[model samples]
Target: MAKKVSDIGGGRSQAVHRALKRAILDQALPPGSKLPEDSIGERLGVSRTLVREALVRLSQEGLVELRPNKGAVVSHPSLEEGRNLYLTRIALERLVVETLSGSLTQEQIDTLSTHIAAEEAARTEHAASIRLAGEFHTLLAQMTGNASLIRYVNELVARSSLILALYGRPHSSECAVSEHRELLDKLIAGKTDEAVALMTHHLDSITTRALLPRKDSLADALHAYAVAEGLA
Candidate 1:
């Protein structure tokens, strides 16, 4: 169970949605874990209607799978599906870099640096570090000021988290953090070609990492996620 919707003061359904979505992204709700409507509704102190709606939204984002009469479960992206996702992300992120390299405002740069700092701080925490790593890309897309691009990047990043949960090596975040720093340096220098190249390399490395075998059990994964979230 996660925090209650009443704690956040938004519409019950939206709050429940965010809580559940965060749980999924953090791997507290691991890939392929059952998400029973009654259990979730009870946990969040929301109605089954709200829980169902929240799950429907997550399914649309590729974060959850809705099976026939099976209710819902967190998505378990296959290696092939992960590859396709990485391919799409690489193309979209190339466009993001191309648009932002020579045009980023100091404010945007500062915000990005701040995000990197947060990533650095979370380095010892696996789930937090990985989620921030994905968010770094979403933040970049947001800087482009394109609503459609932002939406697509957000969805892809969410799915990417699931991919990593299913296949990434435990030490994957170390390389990702270093590459993010390098990519930021290139962007700040306005090296469009270099930035794009680094972005491609960064994404390729992620895809490679996601193809590795994951050895952690679901209980172990949830424990790590809970510790990272200060719930342990």
Candidate 2:
């Protein structure tokens, strides 16, 4: 828990939000799991008000659903919903690659290469690799320098993580690293069509693995994330 309510009031709400978000993305808080305000507040040493605030923010980002009086739960996408999410992601990423093609600086290429190397190194750590894989797309969107695109990509990437956690089998992050490296090469080489095609194919492969089918203790779920966020 935080040392003071004032602390939570100031900026610790984002800490609470990050903890819950990380927990959800990593499947520590699986889809449809209850997120009671009091329990979260007590566990994180924040007030219910802060917890509610954090949850509201997550809800805005489509990671949490706020029921009228039942409080919040992780958003559980249906099979159809999940499919649509990935379809939309494919379109957005196509745009991302299009925007980035012929525009990638040597520095951006180096950054992406470094990120892929990190992904390769973290492949054995399932959760970290998954998070990094999703981040790779967001990094591309960030490079596009479109605020709206960045926001949408960030939200989609996060929800995609949640969806994969819910319905996906153990996938090969190694495959992702190789695909990302190839896609980057295409973009850096200014081959827009090939880059877009590869981007589509890469995202499609993940979608194929996901869109299939598919909980934990609330306090236990929140504990590790809260501690990581300096809330416990």
lDDT of candidates 1 onward, in order? 0.85, 0.85
The digit string of per-residue lDDT tens for model 2 on 1-232 reads 5444664255688889999998888778888999999899888888888899889989988899999978789999765666788899999999999999999988989899999999999888767788889889999999999999999999988887777776765655658889999999899889999999999988888865444532347886577679989999
Give candidate 1's whole-model lDDT: 0.85
Q: Which sections of candidate 1 miss by over 4 Å?
A: 1-11, 213-232
lDDT of 1 by residue, 1-232 (tens): 6554443344777888889988988889988899999898887877788888889989989999999987798988887788889999999999999999978889988998999999999888878887899899999999999999999999999888878767777767887887888888898889999999999988987876545634657876588569989999
Number of clashes recorded per candidate: 0, 3
RMSD of each: 7.9, 10.4
Query: What's model 2's TM-score?
Result: 0.82
Off by over 4 Å in 2: 8-11, 210-232
Window of ten residues with lowest summed lDDT in model 2: 207-216
